[model samples]
Target: MAQAEGTYDEAQIRAEYADLTRELIARGLQVSTMESATSGQIASLITDTEGASAVLRGAYVTYCNEAKVKCGVPAEVIRAHTVYSTQTAEAMARACRRSYAANIGIGVTGTMGNVDSANPAASTPGEVYFAICTGAGSDARGEKNHSFHVHLAPQPSRLMYKLAVAKEVRDRLVVLLAEAAA
Candidate 1:
């Protein structure tokens, strides 16, 4: 958390995700991801370490609107709030949690560094939306925890943006885990 925005190196970001993976494994919690702008990078990172199979149930790369809809994100959600909004992110998380039966589900969507050609009016460069839906909250849909929108500083590369988002998710998840344990 000490690191400044957009300044985390690849190694630091890897450690964040790897560390979070270990924490989840330790807690015997299953995790799944439905990713967009970050693609499947976070899922890939979670599976990089040993014992990942024990915790990572599945992942979906919902990079396009159709893919998101087909993967369980309601088409109506996208129609009401563009693919990059917090609503879509939350829906992605809840939908994946239900589909994969994971204890925790992560969703991410955003424009990397430029307006989206496919939806320019809704695009905001360096803006990201992410949500963490956990079993902790038994809403009508059984997914509740946290969701956020972030405007990242311009990084040197797109990879850094992805890492920044990963770090945010990891950091938030850690707190939520701690809170749940308490």
Candidate 2:
């Protein structure tokens, strides 16, 4: 679907979210999230859908590296990866699962705006990393997980960028859930 000048496709997002919620409910799986760049938007979108409580365990808005570390993301991992790499994303997801004991854990982190003095040049704006993890039953030691990195060049407005990232995260989760169901 085409996006307008500076807005996201809310209708499409809602429809997709509905499908996601349905699948999670059907599978009797619970999900939790630890978000950074997109803050808690991903988790918010998930819970906005009907029947969310059945599948959504909880969510954390770890906007700062300190908060990420507090929530289980290893400080060493963040130090090495700048809190924007796939490693940090994976660690955040694993931590979410361990913290909530949920079947699925999601982690989102990255730069969402123009580079500033405080922001490292290596972390490009509109570049985001998403990690989704599933507990492998008896062994919940962070074995089964998936991570994706996306670059939205010519980035849109801040709100639009955030909306787009949230949609991508939701769509990916749907695919993962479908594959697990099959």
Candidate 3:
């Protein structure tokens, strides 16, 4: 992909989002999202595409622990593990599916706070986790994909990092949706 001459490669990101949206609708699936750290960037990108309403259900920009709970994420789950863990992502995906009645639900969380050397795990500023919930029955199954410790250099700035993460999430979802359809 040719890099756009801007802070973010908006053209590339939009192209990927369009493809993902097309594939999701073609597969007769709908999607919703619950997000943190990346804020609502992922949700915004999905909705920005035309015909998104056909397969894009809704999104919860649950940037706070309280918001996550209000959005249907179980309190016990968040209490057991902080919002940055894989388990939290799974819970968010499951909750999004139930709340929005979507065929696929995406949950994303990451760290963007001050990095503390004392807490090595919190050092990475762009670590993200994504979960995709599938199936229709009450006992729906979902899969979790982690970006692990993505350490974006300081030059990109926080907004750029978030945009990059949104693009990555969209690209990954496209692959997963295609695989599921196959």
Candidate 4:
């Protein structure tokens, strides 16, 4: 079958999400999500699709450090690696997996700090990290982290960066889930 081609639009995202749910259901798998900056957008998108209950276990929008810790992210892990770091993303994924007992779990973390040059260089305003983890039952039982450093130079703003980061993370996860199922 030929794959569809287009930039991510609402239609494309919905279609991909539907496909993901279908594949998971067919395999008797389930998913859980941990989100920070995206603020539950990914989870909401998945649940918006019909029949998502078959594969979507639940989602946690851990928007605060305390919530992350409460939801199973270790305080030491957060201290060693900032909340926006890839390590935090991985921890979030694993924590979600353990908490929800889902076959697959995903985590996302990011920040939209001020763009001033003096700010910490390790994490930029538009940088986002994503991690996908499969449970012990799956062959892909590990975490995958991806970072998007969107340097929207001339037109940078907190809202713009946040939206860009969220969209990119969602689109990438859709592709990753499809590939993993294949």
Candidate 5:
């Protein structure tokens, strides 16, 4: 049980997230999140670092269609694009961004492991969508809008898939956050 001495402890401090958090703080940029399939994992990771409050104020877990709508994701976007589509994710990002008026907004929605019964026709297992909207033009990351979708390979378990997706977002955010100073 104690094989690796200093390699994999219970600290669970993801270097990338911590670095991203530091960068955001250094640049005086703030971030907010709206999440679905990945839940609050992205937000959770971002705040893992010290002084994260300087950059991250709050986040939302819109696990259901109603929750997403209640949190500000427009009803029309969900109806037209379905909660699992990139449009919905973009809506989530923009909504959270406006909600907190933060420089960055992170929105993620998807079917992690199961077909969504609420919208089964559009749900594809392991398929997810996420968007990052920034006020880069106004002294933040350059691109005002960025979006991504991924189909996780059939594998280990639900936890693994979620971790994979969270890491995916973290990696992409690293790229985006790096542009803050540029």
Candidate 6:
């Protein structure tokens, strides 16, 4: 199989970002993100389009366990489910929403190769976990609303994986927002 050095669909991402920002602005909703494996690529993509400031509250690049915990991911959850699991991702999402007072919060965590030997909770290379939360309670702990889990087996280049994950996150956010709008 051919390996893509970097295969981000900029046009598609731009369209999605435009639509997402428009809908959020229309509804007076704010969005934020907690990113790990993909670093801040998700937030970067969202902020790339115009009018993003209206809906984007900023993001936390919680690529480390400490950062994730500091941002609102429970330490116990990480211990129990590992930082790469859905549980941690959900917690991260909820925390972002609460901390940023955003209507929508997205958490993305996974291993993008060069796994940290110190973290036994790290997942297989290219395995990613995502959670999108909404209507988070006033409590800083927050609540989980939605989740997406996937593994890009035979993972492409690190850059390709990040782009793929960003695209997935964007696509999922669009669908969730559309559902809420209905």
Of 1 and 4, the candidate ahead on lDDT is: 1
TM-score for each model: 0.93, 0.88, 0.80, 0.73, 0.85, 0.85
> How many clashing pairs per prediction, in order?
0, 0, 0, 0, 1, 0
lDDT of 1 by residue, 1-182 (tens): 12337567789778878888898899899999999989888898899888999999899998889999998989999999988888999999988887888899899998888899998999988888899999742243655848888888888887887888888778878899999999
Ranking by TM-score: 1, 2, 5, 6, 3, 4
**C-alpha local distance difference test of each model:** 0.85, 0.80, 0.70, 0.67, 0.80, 0.79
Better model by lDDT, 3 or 6? 6
lDDT of 4 by residue, 52-150 (tens): 898788899998789999998898987888776778888888888767888777888865554423225455654567677676532334544443333
Pitting candidate 1 against candidate 2, the one with the higher lDDT is 1
lDDT of 1: 0.85
Model 5 poorest 10 in a row by lDDT: 1-10
Model 2, global lDDT: 0.80
RMSD in angstroms, all models? 2.7, 3.4, 4.8, 5.7, 6.2, 3.9
The residue-by-residue lDDT of candidate 2 on 1-182, one tens digit each, is 12223346877776777778787788788889999888787777778778899988889999888999999989999888777889999999888987888888999987877763454755777678889988943247755879989876554577667778888788788788767668
> What's the CA error at residue 153 for candidate 1, in Å?
0.5
Q: After superposition, how far is residue 75 of candidate 2 from its true place, in Å?
A: 0.4
Instruction: Give the winner by TM-score.
Output: 1
Q: What does candidate 4 score on TM?
A: 0.73
Judging by lDDT against the true structure, name the best candidate.
1
On the 0 to 100 scale, the lDDT of residue 107 in model 3 is: 85
- In the range 1-182, model 6's lDDT, one tens digit per residue, is 11223456667766777777777788888888999888888788777777889888879999789999888888999998898888898998888988888888899987765566767546676677899998844554545479888765444577667778877777788788778778
**Model 3 lDDT tens row, 1-182:** 12222345767777777777777767778888898777888778777777888987889998778999999888898778767677788888888877887877778876654553433553355456667776563345543333322444343577676777677667667677657658
